[model samples]
Target: MESVSTSSVMDILNLLKACCSQSCNYIMTYGGTFSSLASEVGQLKDKSSDVKRDVEAATRDGQTPRSEVLGWLSSVQDMEGEAESIERKYNQKIKCLCSFPLNVCSAYRLRNRAEAALATIRELKQSAEFTKLADNLNLTRSIKMPTTKTIGMDKVFEELQRHAKDDSLSVIGIHGMGGVGKTALLRRFNNDFPSETEADVVIFLELSIDYKLEEVQKSLFDRLSLTWQDEVTHRDRATKLFRVLSTLKFILLLDNLWEPLNYQVVGIPLPAPPSKCKIIFTTRTEDTCSHMGTEKMIKMECLEEEAAWNLFRNSARMDVIDADKNVRIEARDLVKECGGLPAALIVLAQAMAPKKTWEEWMHALTIMKDTPHQLPGMTNNVFSILKLSYDRLSSDNMRVCASYGALFIKGSWIGKFNIRNSWIGEGIIDNVQNVMDADHKTQFLLGILHAASLTVRVHDDYFTMHPMTRAMILWVQRECGKKENKWLVWDRERVEEAPAAEKWRDAERIALVWNQISDLPEAPQCPNLIFLDLQVNKFLRKIPNGFFLHMPLLRILELQETSIEELPVSIGNLMQLHYLNLCKTRITSLPKEMTALVNLKYLSLAFMKYLRIIPDQLISSLRELQWLIMMDSYSGWKEGQSCEGGVSFEELESLKRLKVIGMTVSTLAALQNLCDSPRLAPLTH
Candidate 1:
């Protein structure tokens, strides 16, 4: 009993000693622990500041904060608040309990709180060491772009969206004329990407009139969050881009593609079969679409009339447009002048929005009709945009050939054959030895023009220039100074009579088509004249005696569907004439003097129902003649028979350069002559 009692007393004594020792420790370590907590909290605050700074910088560069980093920052904030609260309580307890050693309970509670906060602060400081402060923003999968309200593009947009999701299609192309809203459509397409798309990233790039491959490379690098090193080689950059692109599903939107760009050259792997990556591009030419190997092509046509008015009314505000009947009339007429092109309509509407009076509208209309490009917004926005297509043409020959579209009436469907022949006659297509080669080159050039979107193909053998495009071309030509001044165009100028001799003196090319010119000057000293078009001059019955005398350098003379019945004797003086079109004329006979034309290459007399005679030797004397179209007009061939100095089929055999001949034979002898001659028989159609 004595031993057990002694053990129990010893345990009680040990417990009291332990309590006394813990109390002493709590009192002694309180200040150090609080200091430690304050120091760690300050360190955490500094770390948080550094991290926030880094995050801000990364965000400025189009990056976003990492999820883990954000969580850590939030934890640090909470820890800082707790540490601050503990410090305030400790300070308050010390201040209130100063010189009073009896308040151990308050001191103990404050010490306990500081100890707890110190531990938390230390943990936060340890976690503040972040290798990466922020992650890439990944350039939003679909950026909301600022664009004009879509007009007549809902169906096209829906169709494009379907094509974009199509499993079999990897590349889609949108092609149309300049200022036809291709870029606008692309912007809308990019902004309206579905949330459920499989794409992990979408990159939009605008290849300028002369974009470089490095520009594309840099865009990829930026969007992919790869560091761009300026000192690296192009191949190295391409490899880097390809490495990242191969692992992710992405959509690349390429806008304003002037020509075919090799995807491989730019380090873009072709999204061929089995690849989830896709590419879409917008260009002004279908040729680009074909060359780029697009799986689907959507042609962006001009808005319909009603849709155009809607767009215009929205832009110009309907209140002003419908304020007066005259204003509405003028507005509708102005829309027609815009030719349903969105860019033109938008610009014109904006320019006309401020003018409320009918007179002001009328003045604007007159200016638009006369010089559309000179209007306020037309030059900068519409015409200059169209000029890019012309400026990026492959060569000067193409530019010149394209400029010829301006010579015709605006918005007219130009016959491809006539255009090709005109190109041949102007010496634009040189260095060819045979008519076949010339035709081949002509076809290639036509393809180039079509691909450039300078001319829109209406059919296989016809193309038409947009009215706005024509106006832009004419403006460009006029801007080239004196060189283009030689081209005199009066077709759309509302000129009833031929210009005075002074206007015709320095002209190199003249277009007097669709006019009521009843007479021409006796002679104009046009020493540099190369082209003259008198087409569709219904009232023109006679050519002055010396109309062709001074045009020694004349190369093309067109008088199709004219009322003229005879050619002047001076017609033979145009020694350099290459193309002579008298189709649908009233001429009954050809003079013998036409035999002087040795350089004539293309001669068309088709539909000349009143044509009856071609003096013998006249056709053969044109040693350079290659194309002769007389089908449905001249069938007065009589072989081995003398009939009013008429041309025989056998005489056609003498012409060695003729490659295409379209004429009819009315006599058996003529048919036999045609079959007997190897050259003529092979060329005859």
Candidate 2:
């Protein structure tokens, strides 16, 4: 697995040239009789090849058996083996240089036998024959393809033909439920799209995961057989590909198109006025399909009842579908519960696949009856069955995490990118100990919530949760404030420890933690408390007394996590403080003395929660402060809260410590797109 760097590939090429040169020179010096054979071997090579262009150019012009003589010289080198055992056995290492697609072993076997036979010639010092043998060491490179076919895609051929015929500014889309056949279909196309046409170049780009515009552009440029040899940025790469597309008729299959992006801004052509170039795409939403302006949006129909029955038959493969009438009836009932979504149908059918009697099917049906469905336009009901796993968590963070389902309970496709942005904007994530490059802040939360079954990861970095799970989050948010399992309080047993850990955990737990807690906690320790979220809590009128001294660990302490409002004078003692988020809190203004925490990372003096002006010192001494989320969370005063990031990513770069972290997804599309974090391991709510 050596990296294919220029220096490495170049070094290899140099060594190969030197080996060929030595063999050729040794042959020409020989006064042997194998001249005719050498001439024949040299004739088989073309000048454009690596061996011919480099080695053949230097042989004595009229020399006939030059290579023939060198092939013999190879025996002399072998016999003069630095160590006697070198020639004792043929190692694959020697013959691996032979140009073949991993047939290095076979090449070694043949070279080994040649060595054994030529050992006699080596001992005799037949310089001519040894040179001839050396010249015979031919190595060439060959490309290889995987032998077996990738499974589960039956619609590839049809799509390929469609793309080929409509190559003029065309947009063919594939829309279906998660895990059905959209991505797989595109994958199959990626594998076999290049047929025989010279204008035929296929490039596949994923718009969901790792949605960096540069990545898409680079993939397209590479496929078009073009290279700038310069650092092509995200913007430039997109531009380069667009320029290429305008000339060459290429097949560009944009996968997981969820948003209505202006590709032109990124240097690619728009879909509205067809350019007579084929651009096939796949989306889960009809709205996205329409935006592409495709002549035909194949609204994928659900698997037919017969198709569902067959899926059940294949999955179950039991006698229930054959002999027992009552068993068959129950099996049919199971399929109905799956709603004909292929992913659900197969997953559900498989659980019952091995069952025999009617009673087992009946019990399963009973369980299915209990699970709830997502809201309108959010048909994520199939996995309500998975929500049962969340109930098993023992932690409040775990329970609060169950609320992730509520966002999806409404059938919202929470793209991973937008979710990451939401998590950051909402201030759910704080900092992490470099478990896996702390750069991935939200990923940790994703893993924890996913493990707790409070979130269901969907296609293209999108995630969702069942309505029941969303209900669980609401319950946890309400319960987090209770004295017994208060989400805002630090470990009751370890109050002097870090309330930041407790508060941070609770903040990340709620759909909007700032909206759940009334004020910051009073822990004597925990300097890692960077975020203070006072978002949703409506009960408070002022900050806790001496709150600043008690929470020296406070970075961003938001009181909006509950119904409380107010600011305590002791809030200024936090020296290591960073982000101070008081979005929905009822605080009026920061005390001029509290601006002493010169390390504030982000300071939001926004109004909607109704604060007027930032502390005069906050505008100056707190030099490192960056992001400011001052917009309304749905008019913070009343019930219908709007949770959106009011700050722009561009303006926040001035803070220096801030990074545009996480894969951000827009709320309008999907939520599951960004649930890639594994660090939120112990803190998922």
Cα error, residue 212 of model 1, in Å, equals 1.8
Task: Give the number of the best model, judged by TM-score.
Answer: 1
lDDT: worst 10-residue window of model 2 = 133-142
Tens-digit lDDT track of model 2 for 136-184: 1111111122322223234444745565565353677676444445665
**Candidate 1 local lDDT, 56-117, one digit each (tens):** 75665446678988998888888888887887776665443423324677877777887887
Q: After superposition, how far is residue 27 of candidate 1 from its true place, in Å?
A: 45
- Model 1 residue 475 CA deviation (Å) reads 1.9
Error of 1 at 509 (Å): 2.8
lDDT of 2 at 469: 43
Q: How far in Å is the alpha carbon of 610 misplaced in model 1? A: 4.9
**Model 2 lDDT, residue 430, Cα:** 38
Pairs that collide in candidate 1 are none
